[model samples]
Target: MTLKFGDPDLEGLKFLQDDPLVITPIIGNCHVMRVLVDNGAFVDILFHNTFIRMGYNDSQLTPSDAPIYGFNHMECKVKGAIQLAIIIGEEPREATQMLNFQVVKAASTYNAIIGRTGIHTFKVVPSTYHMVLKFPTRNSVGEARGDHKMAHSFYVITLRPDRTGGQPAEDLVPIPFDPLDPEKVTYIGASLDKPLKDRIKTFLQENNDAFTWTVAKMPGIDPNLITHRLKVDPTRKAVKKKKRTYAPDRLEAIKKEVEKLLEARFIEEVQFPEWLANPVMVKKANGKWMMCIDFTDLNDACTKNCYPYQGLIP
Candidate 1:
């Protein structure tokens, strides 16, 4: 049935202004935040990141054979479809629909996209002018109100280039998460099917000890499975390079990284290191510093595998 609105429904139009209409919908069963209602989109979509946040594992996703292409002509692999229970709004009014969402890994302004398929299924009419969505429930016409304030915040959260064309000017604020603690391990976003969601919660609880919360608690890899051996040429004497200096900020970052490595037992302080490799500080795209080692001298001295392995094409 086509959507019809009264004067009372049109009253909400004032909130629209220039902001995109974004709503919080109950997907699967969790109240999924930042759902964009895009009438242009042909199919419903659940972002891969949002799918995980819904406490779903890859195993639960059904494989999709079709490749989805965007308006930009970029082809994206469909992760698979997930049947989710969608609740449009809260009681005493709500419209419920069971939908198959094609899971994708692309980044977007919203967590999930309620597209044309969903619009047709739920018989929803979205009003950008009204800044709200209207749909029919069994009892009455339900509304999923758009959050104008939250929509604006999503813009700020998106990664964007600054004038210098370096790192993104804004990065997502870090959320404190503990993988080992089951209580703290709850997926903070979205609604999901209770049975399936509870199953995932139980899975995390059961395997709590399997997660390594910090580097200090790491047990490390066993030598029998795999080990790295530096094949340095003994004939060529080890080159102990002169210590390199870094800027104050870079020096602090290097020192902190070195201390972490020592604490994690990944590296140990020795009175004298035969092959001294200087620390290299590099700026990351997120405006963070990465500490690396300059092993050019060491790598140059190592013997190359001149002969190719058997069965490898030349």
Candidate 2:
């Protein structure tokens, strides 16, 4: 008989209440990590960054045409998919099967998310009140317990907005100064007209928390909400070039800038990262050097977004 949510096996769970269902499951035979068992989601998502951390390569992804949407109904970019063997229960009760997951460039508190499709695949019934997932393997019922405290923590983490080091380096264009509040400023391409500038300045000053002037001002987005992940092609062999040396002055400036970003929690150190890319130093017109990652090789592997450009025609 197929397992059902209200099965008598779950009756003992009525005593518990008020917690989201969360559990840690092993993936690719790696250490067990937390995954939010969300029956509401139609698709299972394995974050690109988390996939890399779990020792998976980008080439493993099988291109998926179906796009996934977030709670806000915005279309999320799907990099690809990979099939992995998933095990739910322990010992004789264990049920293992190959599962396909669509990889995305999202960051979340959970390493992986198992959605309704995954739940159905395991033929399991999940209960938030019981904090457990129940399924029948053979004639016996198998149970996977949920981590209540962890699930609640992840719930709080996903609500935050996405943020990065003072905006992306590509958007480092000239900003307009606030006339009324001399200390304030607006991002690139602001209206040059004095009246409009003043109005923008006043509005910004009124909503100061919305504007971040320096690294100290940035309240980064929750990693779970949105995260930047480079989809490096794993099929391509890894490349590591010798570190390029820079002039003393330029090196000093890079060090200082890196320190500021680190202090602001915009970037964290990672060990033995895969998909190496060289940093290119560009000489700005102001004689200062700007650092940018040379992702030419990385870009070659990604699916391009072809938004047609209409030149100067109204």
lDDT of 1 at 278: 85
* Candidate that would win on TM-score: 2
Q: Per-residue lDDT tens digits of candidate 1, residues 26-144? A: 88878888898988788899999999988998999898865677755778768899899999977977988899899998766579998899999988889865677888776677888
Candidate 2 Cα errors over 4 Å, as ranges: 2-17, 155-166, 169-182, 188-314
What clash count does candidate 2 reach? 3
lDDT of 1 at 49: 93
Off by over 4 Å in 1: 1-3, 6-16, 162-314
In terms of lDDT, the poorest run of 10 residues in model 1 is 305-314
What's model 1's lDDT at 246?
Answer: 79
